[model samples]
Target chain A: MTIIANAPYDFTSNDRQEDFRGAMLVYVGWARHMMFASPYCWPLPPDMPFGALVEGPMAQAFAQHPDWEQADWSTATWTRNGEPFTPDLSKSLADNGLSHKDSLMFTTPGLDGIGGMGF
Target chain B: MDIAVTKKKLGLKERYALMTRGLGWEPTYQSVDDVFPMDSFEGIKIHDWDAWEDPFRLTMDAYWKYQAEKERKLYAILDAFAQGNGHLTLSDARYINTVKLFINGLAPLEYMSHRGFAHIGRQFRGVGPRVACMMQSLDEMRHAQTQVHAISNYNRYYDGMANFRHHHTYLPYLQVPRSFFEDAASGGPFEFITAIGFAFEYVLTNLVFVPFISGAAYNGDMGAMTFGFSAQSDEARHMTLGLEVIKFMLEQDPDNLPIVQKWLNKWTWRGVRVLTLVAMMQDYMLPKRVMSWAEAWEIYFEENCGALFRDLARYGIVMPPCVEQVRKERDHLSHMAWCQFYQARGTNNFHVWLPSKEDMDWLSAKYPETFDQYYRPRFEYWAKMEEEGTPFEAATPPQQCQVCQIPTIFPVAGDPLTRAEHSCTHDGERFHFCSQWCQEIFEDEPEKYVQAKLGAHELYKGNLFGDADPTAEDFDPMAAAMAFLKLTPEDSGLHSDSRDAANFDLWRGLAKANEA
Candidate 1:
């Protein structure tokens, strides 16, 4: 279980402050942690607790970035199958029905109202 | 009584004029723009219609006579192969899956090519390009018919060969190639030429035809080899048309370069994406391999097209933007795509098998960097599972790309094991794509691609296999899916490893007997 990171545009990395932008990022082959990214991003590990996924490397990557740290996390919305994600950060993504072949999206409030970075 | 009449033969220039310009007439009542309204809509500016050149200079009579002769020769070979029991001469019955793929996937596209070219032939104002399109239309028809006639021998004894035309339209996997050609056919004339003639024929035809024909030769599929051989000259002509048309368009107006470049980028990626079937066939399906998929890509595409791009730089045409990803993924695409096929073989018309130890060794030799490390273990896992009496099949269909309609099996960058997923937010509904190129293709024209009937998406909506129709009483989704695929228990059904399994056992038995 590995995932490849292919972004069609240049976006700041969630965990790494390094500017990651290209049509293809890196071949993330054969990994146990897999999730789906839409509008161009990488799949994250679904087995990890939702809190770790949000507050862990992913959130840290987006949080400490020079340009993106100003974004407010309180206005974020996560949904699975059109239902809003519950704030029970203790549950693993797999426990919440975010498995391989399933699609999930996370969006924070943005000026455009379509929200901030989502996938 | 012998009657002698002084008959004069038409000179080459005179014959060309009479055949092309002689046959065409300007509309007396309508403006030329009204007569050829569809050609200009794509924003390609053709300043001079007469500037479009036809190198072949073929006329209707000559085209018919030459094509008739080609058909005659091809049919003779087909008949001889059938009467001589050529099926027994093949490397193995498993080898026919390659043939099945060609018939089921590519042959119908030839017919579509004919229809597309015919549409363009009628629409273009230039007699030269128009005649060339007409000739290509005829060539495509011949290619399609010859491919069917050649492979018709297999339909005689095989189960899956019976209903390919039906499968091509309705089957989920087939939507990959079907939607590609259908998109081309529905475009304006200039875009149509760029899509088929320039992008497909000029750039990628060799990648598709060469491997299959070489495999046919290596595997002793003489009937298929003959048809492939007969179709080569026409392919060459089509390639010429492709190159010529691109040059013509670029040279016609400076404004045309960007439009042609856009089509070049889009169709080049689309054409290569459609060749996933060929990639799988070359790597996994062929019993006696002719060449590794990577090697073929290097020799045919990387080396040749690199030079082609350098030549086109003068006209502001660069290599396709997707070429880098294509080169990087060459080692992985076949393995990833084949794994998907192996998982979904129950739904496919072909059989699947794990690489034999010898075949694995060959793969290791061919793919020194990646095969043993990444792909081999996956095959071994399946082989061991099969040995343990618990075979693997995906419980559900994989997510499909909205534009290409292929399963999203491509590996993510920096990680080959974890599959990469890409999508775009269009109309507030998230649409998934297989790659950046496919995503851009959809984004460039959202209206055309938004309506894609992806197999996985359709299954989710219960539209697959006519399940969307609530009025039909017997439209059980499962039963309808099976019925539409023509996969009955006794008739056209699933192909498995039993044939190879039996052959291996027989070989071992013969070896033991000789030793004893």
Candidate 2:
């Protein structure tokens, strides 16, 4: 499958329509379960974490973390229709469009876009 | 419904672009703080208006136009259904007993929701959110009137539909919600929002709408569904408003966090207590089964809310403080509350029979957290014993909860007869409650939420109202209305001397209409 990486916040060269595709990642205040898809992609499973785990034990001892593998690393994929998808259905990054876009925020976490910053 | 008339087919475009933000002129005279007083409590600092986002971009005229069209369709359904022999589809005239409980307990609360939301609509400085609230307020009122009107047709057939206005004064079943909103509306605007908006919408709205409305849909109750789904489409907007309002408050002030959390706890318990009547309705009321409270809670709360809370945790909002305890009690609610109704029905008074075992079993399985484990045995035992004809007598209600107005379902982890536990002293009166959660709420701001509650306080003193209106005395409200309508024995079907079918046709002109 074509993994769409950090789909909600990232951008493309083509400034196409709004990306509600991964907007489920941005909840108002409560955790809500969402099953959604990119405009042309199938819904990605919830396990695939896009951000770094800043705190907790995993941050220190990356080993003893028995059987811990990224969700996308173990998947097999194929296509029946025109689309490609992972068997496990985890995180994905769709094809980059042509030169039409606004500034992307997922990459530049330090810059809040208005200039202040999120990270 | 006359399919052409419903606004759903017309698909009103959300017009907020024009009526809300579109109509909002820049407030040159007043600063943002002057216009919207509630902002600035959340620690998160934002200097730009663009940071505020409205997910449902609704406009005012779109709301009114669609809502108006929805009402017209509902009224037409009531008219056409009544004009036909729609009453025959009912399982029995006795079934209206459930509808009577509905009119008395739920109908008026809709109006209160409307009034409360109107206040919110005007208060929020943000045009997008305010307009959403305005639309919700309008829908709430429509829901109230439509419910009363839609059920009024059954008045001619059922013994109980006419008595809602009177029975509510003494009926424990009806008093549950009445006592609740009376307290909610009487309190401060914030308290009302916490009570009705956040508590009712965020927590309890699904319990009523999903089970109750779905039952109406499954039971061939067309007018009811048109009314419910039409109102519910707007209800999601209210839910959005609730989530937005709470988040907006928390985002504006960090100190508001602790305060809002307390309310989340208080209102959740209060609202759950008030919904006991709905629980009874689910487990025992409908002739055709719908989802049980446990199942509804599983899907709406465990799944939907579980996800919602986890997302909120990232932003620092916690679930209602005592949610785990609430989670544990879902199974107990349906059986116990329905027992209350069955008890009320025993005296040849008001109540509905339980749905078929199939519905009960479905509920048990779907709500594994509640039914399949803890509550299922009780259902199975009751079913088996009931088949052998054991007397199921009405148990006297425990002393009314001082705040929420239902019997304390709060179980003692150890003792049973204590009727739950409480030791909160408010103004020298050591208040008793059904659970630790409720007691904490009473203690937190006794003056605000608890002091004004009229629990079992005034009932023994002989001051229940509604008998004063001559209109309130009949056993069937629609029949009473027909008496006022002077439609003769034929139209007032409850008259002992019901006219023969042929004569009735002549009098009401049913034959001529058929020919036309």
Q: Could you estimate the TM-score for every candidate? A: 0.79, 0.63
Model 2: per-residue lDDT, tens digit, B1-516? 556754544233334455556666667988877776543332223344334556676655556687778778878887887887665555433345556667767777898788977886775566666666677787888888888788887666544455555545444545667766766665544455656766677667776776787887676677666777777777777777677766765676566676567666677777878766777676666766676667677887778778767866755778786777766666666665654444334222344444456766776665665555444444454455456765233222234444565554445433211224344444333344557776666565455444333322332222222233433544553244334322233322211122332333353465346663
**Which candidate wins on DockQ?**
1
What lDDT tens digits, residue by residue, belong to model 1 across residues B206-293?
8777876878889988898889878876988998888888889889899999888888899989988887778888888888988988
For model 2, residues A1-119, the per-residue Cα lDDT tens digits are: 12112123222311112222332111000001000000011112233342221122122222111122321223312221112322322222222211111111111112121112110
Q: How accurate locally, in lDDT, is each candidate? A: 0.71, 0.52
Docking class of 1: incorrect
Q: Give DockQ: model 1.
A: 0.04
How much is the lDDT of residue B168 in candidate 1? Answer: 92
